[model samples]
Target: MVARYLVSPHGGRRAHPDISSALRAAAARRRPARIEIAPGRYEETLTVRGEVELTAAEGPGSVVVGRTRGSALDSFGSVRVHGLTLVGREADAVGCHTGTLTLDHSEIRAHGGVALHARPHTSVTLRDSVLAHGRALFTGGTGLVERCRFTDAADNAVAVLEGARVSVRNSRIEDSRIHGLRVSDAHAEVIGCELTGTGKAALMADARARLTVADCVITAVHAEGIMFIEQSRGTVDHTRVTGARHGIGAASGADPVVRGCVLTDCRDTGINVQTEARGRFEDCQVLNSGNIAVFSTDGGAPEVHGCRVVGGNVGVAVIGGARGRFTHLVVEDLTNTALRVFDEAGAAFAHVRVERCSSGLEVRGNGGTTAEVSDAVFRDVEMAAVAIGGQSRVTLKDVTADGGVLGFGVADEAQLRVTDSTVTAVSGAGAGALGSGRLIARNLTVTGSGSLGVYGTGSAYVDLARSEFTDCATAGASFDEEAGGQVVDCAVNGTRGVAVAGNGRVDTVRLRTSLKVVRHAEKPAGPPPQIINIFNGPVFNGPVRDIQVAWGNENVVQNRGENVRNENENEADAEADTGADAETGTDAETDTDTDTDTEGNGSRS
Candidate 1:
């Protein structure tokens, strides 16, 4: 059985005049006690020892317990307080040490110290209560805070440290001074909570803390909405963060997984992974970010999948020797490059779509940057769909560039290899290599280009094999200014200009019908002179022999007393300079003429 005691300000009929007298009277019962206080103000502190139940006779907000110096309530055993208001002026409102304390339908306020403090070996549960002015500290205990309101805290609303375990549900922590919830070297789970107007990050997990935050709203935070640092690990799912400097950040070897989250109107990057941190962001939406939507730098490599970035400066940036992998990503309405891999970084993108961006993808660095893109689509991009420069190596497979200024641009000692790709409806050359860059393309299709289908200049090298060019406004292929390459088993049809035009040596073999080659008037000043080797002379419309043009000599070789007329007579002379037999179609030996095949069968004599 339980003993019951009643306390009233006016002592009457089996009632104690104060709660202390009542508690003292009940303390000798050697059984569980229930103390009911009347509607009055108690200006004393109470220390609970045994299992005790304290209730207000008139319900919540009717009984007031206040103190000026010490804690209003201290528990060393199991205690339950209901329907009361506890206030402390210069001390903690409630303290639980090696005990279990439960507060329901009450208000706890402290002016100087913590509102509620749970020390080591303590268990605290706060349900449907309000905490004001001071924070709740759990140093080494287990706590459950449900349906609570923490407002105007002088410091972090709630802090879990020193290996404590805490669970906060359906709570509102608003207008906090520092972080709303700080977990350091502890474990916490926060669900269905709203944290707003915090001075710093809404929730900060550091010092190897483990946190799980789900179905939470973090808004108007001054810094990162959720930060995981110092090798901390956690999972944030189904959360929404808005109006923050950065939505989520992980640094210093911290690796957190963020899924099904929405970040909107962030002042800076939506997700920032830096300083050797490796995080994974999946199925998240980042909208209207001021700068990059997803950024990984400083040896940090993040895996992003099934994410969408709408309205940002740069969609995804991987730099500073980081390696990132992105798949099934969609980036639209960006003002800058959709994907940027720079500063000796490497990245791989698969199943990506970029629409209405300034440039689709850019890979550039001093010497060690690399990128690989496959199964991608670029639509309505204002600039080159893919740009490579600065000694970077890039490869594109099964990619489509539609309605862009240029399909692919390679420059500055970069090397690019493209296979099974299509460039259609571009305003400039379908593909170009300049400034000592090298381009190797196989099974590529270029159609509806405003300029040459393929272009190379300035000591660049181009190797095209088994490619097709149709409906190009200029020549199908052109290499000039010491640029040279080989085109093997290719076709050029429906071109408005010549099939091939260049001043450098280009080897063309096994090309399809109506093939034409035009040499420019200016000759390159080096060895390996300008030469066009047409194997098996019957492949052309007329009987034409292989033509080798020496430096300072403009001529077309004659075969069987017939001249292969130059299509553009104003550009270069077509007369035979190398004496050949009019009947046998054999040319005289010259120092530069190294052709050993005399017969028309494309074999050495």
Candidate 2:
């Protein structure tokens, strides 16, 4: 089946058009062929109707397929255009069939209309070809481009319109005003390419397809770096994207995984997952952005792990009914909230985690919803280390809030819990040793504070068990209006042990430290509640020295606040008129406030 021909536009004067025409005729005669054109300029349109092999004497810059009124070649099955230049013309340059079209070592330049239009069943491969200054290459079937250069197309440079799977490798697609590569309802793989310039996007996925851009440099885009408009899942790995409106954006359930990439200098969110889209960024460096580094909104959950986020308005903003989880992430140097989980009206933050932020963690709530926080470390925070309000539930376990303005703030019926943790050297008001909530603190240590460690306002209850308080200006446990607390087996080594407001109660509290004056606005006409110390360590100073039990008040300090009429080595030191009538009785309701001057007593029940 060996067939041959020649096409020479100069009428066989230089062996180009004559070789092409002869090859076309031979291919039309249904014979397998190889038509090699020598170095010459062809000014006529070339067409390969049958199976033909059209090659050049040399490579791209060697053999020139010059301008013609029509296309260079209308190829069919197995039409190979290698090492040839298809220059600008008035009509379509190259139209092909559904078979394999291998275009390599060549340059396909400008055109009045379409550049290369592959038919429905064509499988094209372009290797080391330069597609520059053209309308675009429209393809319907699969296209594989390796080491190709696509530059300066007014429209989409390479449009995969219908169900095409286009894979590009080691390519440079730059300097285009429109999309560098636009794939609608098609799959694309862009690997190791430089997708840059002032284009709309380096890559745009419009429909439900899969696109993977790996080990690529996508920078300086006009609008966005890469966009997944519909249900497209794009996986970008080892890539660097900078100077774009949005580094990576997804809409309508676009699940994208960005791994090991450097996304910087983005005008908007570095990674925006919108409309039920899911994104994951692993071991990436995202910094110096104008907006939030990663913003997940509209019912999306984007997980960021082992990433460094710095120098943004917000490090990671999870708002508008979206949730974000940060595991093993380092977020520091933020202009606004490090991780803001904000919602309005019917929206809420499903889940968020600030395992360890460099500064602190701020949580806000709206519309009868709250925020939950735990297991974090705060250092040198400008404001409260953990601010919980608006009916929020914030818990801190094994947390160390060091040198913050406020260690923890609970307002508006917010709940806080600190377990096995320490708060040291903080200089602020309101909850140092303070606040109102169901504050459950166990095995806790509060040292070197400016104010009280646990102070509360309004019906707040504090339970301290095996907790130690040291070196505070105020009492170790201070309660404001109508608050009740219980301290069991706790050591308070401060200026005072307990200070209670009007009608406040402290039960079974052992104050081994000083028992100072409880400042009341007006001494209650009725007997105020007392502090019952069960297992007394030692009365370092005078106990309840400011109390006058003569005004219809009787038993102040009981043995264990248990029973009366029993002398169980638990003595109440009331300086009554008759010191001889001070009998040890098990009266649990005794209004007698006792100061046990006798120290070193054991087992008072």
Candidate 3:
């Protein structure tokens, strides 16, 4: 049982040449031990209790356990080393406790401290190894590192603490001058690894650590290239992060479940879930980022699905009191606002698509912020394609903004609710309710606007009902008189001049409309715009009560040209002494067409 313990008879007689007298003559001959060392330097201070086999033949200076002042292999029992080289400086180059530290094709270089020093319930195994410039390599216990290589670690190059349990496969953690894999109340399994230049955070699992990263490739991290803070929970799959500052970072109350990741460039905010963290990101790809590419703030509740963001500079920024759920997203080409909801944040995005964005979707905040979008699309937007200002609140369904310049902008004191929308080819104002704003739309459609395709002025409140406005160059629903709105059963064909314009003091109100000369001469036996210009801007039959029609008995609603203009003439004896409903003097007016509905499509002025 002697395959060269360097010229035999070590525990069978007495023959010891260096290696600390052949490990004290194989620990006073208490059994199992085999040492076949050939070519050189073993200034070793080795000490093993039970079984040990330190074999070597050529390679890595052929068996050098150098100048150790303390630990250069001080296992309290079972140890196996094949092709050894523990070039220690002043300490630890392997020191397991109730030991089992196996290393094949070994090498533990420049160890000034910990280069494999497992403690409680020790167990360390590495194949094709290299744990360089150490300060760490399994500090607490149980482990396995295959195809290993952990470089320049002055501290933390694989450190699993307390309740330790580690497993790393196809490894390569490079240039770590600090933290390149540190799991806290431990349990980590990184597969197909490659983490580069970590001066911190190139995979850090905090407190209640339980990490499982799969198919990883993390590059150039100076911080946060996958970090989960306290209360940390598991799972991150198919990861790929580059140039980190924050490429996948979850904070304090962490609860992770990320999948299919690919985060790029990032100098800040590339997928960061905050404080009360609770994450769940799927099919991620956050690119270019120099700021804000998905950031859920303070009170986090992150849940992003089917994500994709390209060229970030504010593409998804939910602030402080965050609560999120971004679904089926694709936020592209952003240099600014592409969903930047402010403070008291509460989010919900479904089936989103925002392209070539400069400003598409921004719900302001004075706290109370809220945003909800469904089946969205904002294309080639260059500012204000959905911007609801301070005191925020926005809700949209089936939203679409094509080639926008300004479509849908509600001002300070904000609140907007749109349903079944479409804002096409806008140059400006295809739906805008100014300061003190409040807009409630239903079945909206605004096409090719160069101005005023739905505009309500200051002290605003616009309620567009069953809307549709086309080719507007001037007005297709313009309001003033300290704007207060109500445009019902709307329809404006091609506008170039006043198609439903209401001026000072009329407080803007319309019912069952179809003007602009009956949609430009196509079938105009005209008789449906009932009250001249049907409540078009500028004095709707003024004198106080203001343009409230549908009480026909004398039929004098004008404007067939030829200079005819009567506009709400006395309203059927002033609404038959208030009995109302002469078409609609306002009994809340029902049937504009089909199944009765005067209010409740959504209201809150």
Candidate 4:
């Protein structure tokens, strides 16, 4: 039915009174019916049952369908509407009934209720159209929305659910009272879209939904910018988000991958991966966050690498039995702790640098917690830097803590192995060990402290070997009653008080005291216990040094602490090349921070 009708105001000669009647009579066209109506307001409930094209008789934006009681159109077959304005009240403008609906250069303005809704297996397409002041499109099938504008929508701009596949490209949605784009048990692809002033998350995927958002900009979201929860998975690529509560979040077994995104000025955590979820964040820059910049918690293990987090209250906090790995990170200028791990959680940090924070690197666990850390550098912290407590067995290697009030503190039942490290406390002390903890500081240098270099109390054992301490106000190192240690080949200078004071047996051989010369400390009166060089206060009373003395060239004499020693003149002379390298050799700084009750050999039950 190739028909043309003129409206009342536009010179009507042979015209239909209503668009619905014209559409019904024209449905018998072999090809799609083409009915051109003049530009005017028509009042009817149009129910289309066949393929038809209802075009404007004059031009675009001139045909109007107004004063509708229910939906303007109920489509059961393919319907294409061009250059039309549909204004409805208390009902949807277009309801698709198991058919395809296409709108071009159109506008749907509803007072109350949805603008367009498609049932199961029904699709909808909007090209250069606007849906405003309504609960916008709900898609249960494939939905394609391009170059559209959705504004002041009371509910979600687009809801994709029930196994639908939706694509929205080059669109803009603003001031949505609910979520801007919501997907549940569906898949959605949003590209080159801008969403702003959303009351909820700009994009939300839940209940096995798989979503991908690329080259999008979202701002002023009251909730998270992007959310993947309830076993959903998504990817956000090259997106920019600002002024949201949370920038991106993955929870409830969701595994989202966020790559090449810039998140700034979030009210809460910038990136939150929680609830046993495993997310990957790569090449992201998160700045000026109100709370934690990156948070991995609730037994989740998120991998964050090559990221920069700056100016948050706390940066990169992993809690709630979570385990994660942070590599090649640069976090700086935080108001509080830069890296915090707590609540039976573990985090491995490699090649991390933290600067200008109140504190840095706090690892805490109550009963069963552990972690491995290596190659970390902290500088210019105001409060204590690197506080480890609460029964956590942490291994730190090649760490440098410089210029802080209290350099490091280990308390409770924590076991910390600080190896190949340097601690410089310009205003305070270095390494406070308390509460029956075990601290092994090997090959470490502590310099320029205003107080004691190492303070240990409450049965804590402080092991020092091949370490150097200088410019101390009080004793170089002090241990209270019941604390024990062995300091071998350590150089200490400028201690105003006693060089070392403790009730435990301390063996100081070739140790430099306040006199700036290497001398043996006079052994205490009690007989030495029975252990050999492993240092258990007094373990070896007999001749502990082995005497298989076949003397050789000094250069070829490779003497390790595990080797049996002999006291021949040439061998003794060869051993005296400061004999410190054996105890100072690098112990392998690698261990898993987990909740299992496994020993050092890493056997899990």
Candidate 4 per-residue C-alpha lDDT over 516-561 given as tens digits, one digit per residue, 9 for 90 to 100 = 2112212222222122111001010111111010001111121323
**lDDT tens digits, residue span 20-123, model 1:** 88788777776799999999889989888788999999999889898677778888788999998998777888889768999999999889879999998899
| Candidate 4 off by > 4 Å | 1-11, 58-60, 470-475, 493-505, 509-605
Report the C-alpha lDDT of model 3 over 443-467, residue by residue, as the tens digit: 8898887655776665777888778
TM-score per prediction, in order, is 0.85, 0.75, 0.44, 0.81
Ten residues in a row with the worst lDDT in model 2? 534-543
lDDT of predicted model 1: 0.80
Candidate with best TM-score: 1
RMSD of each candidate? 11.8, 13.0, 14.8, 12.9
How far residue 78's Cα lies from its native spot in candidate 3, in Å, is 18
Give the winner by TM-score: 3 or 4: 4
For candidate 3, the per-residue lDDT at 570 reads 20
The per-model lDDT (C-alpha) reads 0.80, 0.62, 0.71, 0.73
Question: Which candidate tops lDDT?
Answer: 1
Per-residue CA lDDT of model 2 for 205-251, tens digit only, reads 87887788899898888887888877777788999989988888887
Better of 2 and 4 by lDDT: 4
Q: Give the better candidate number (2 or 4) by TM-score.
A: 4
The C-alpha stretches of model 1 lying farther than 4 A from their native spots are: 513-515, 521-605
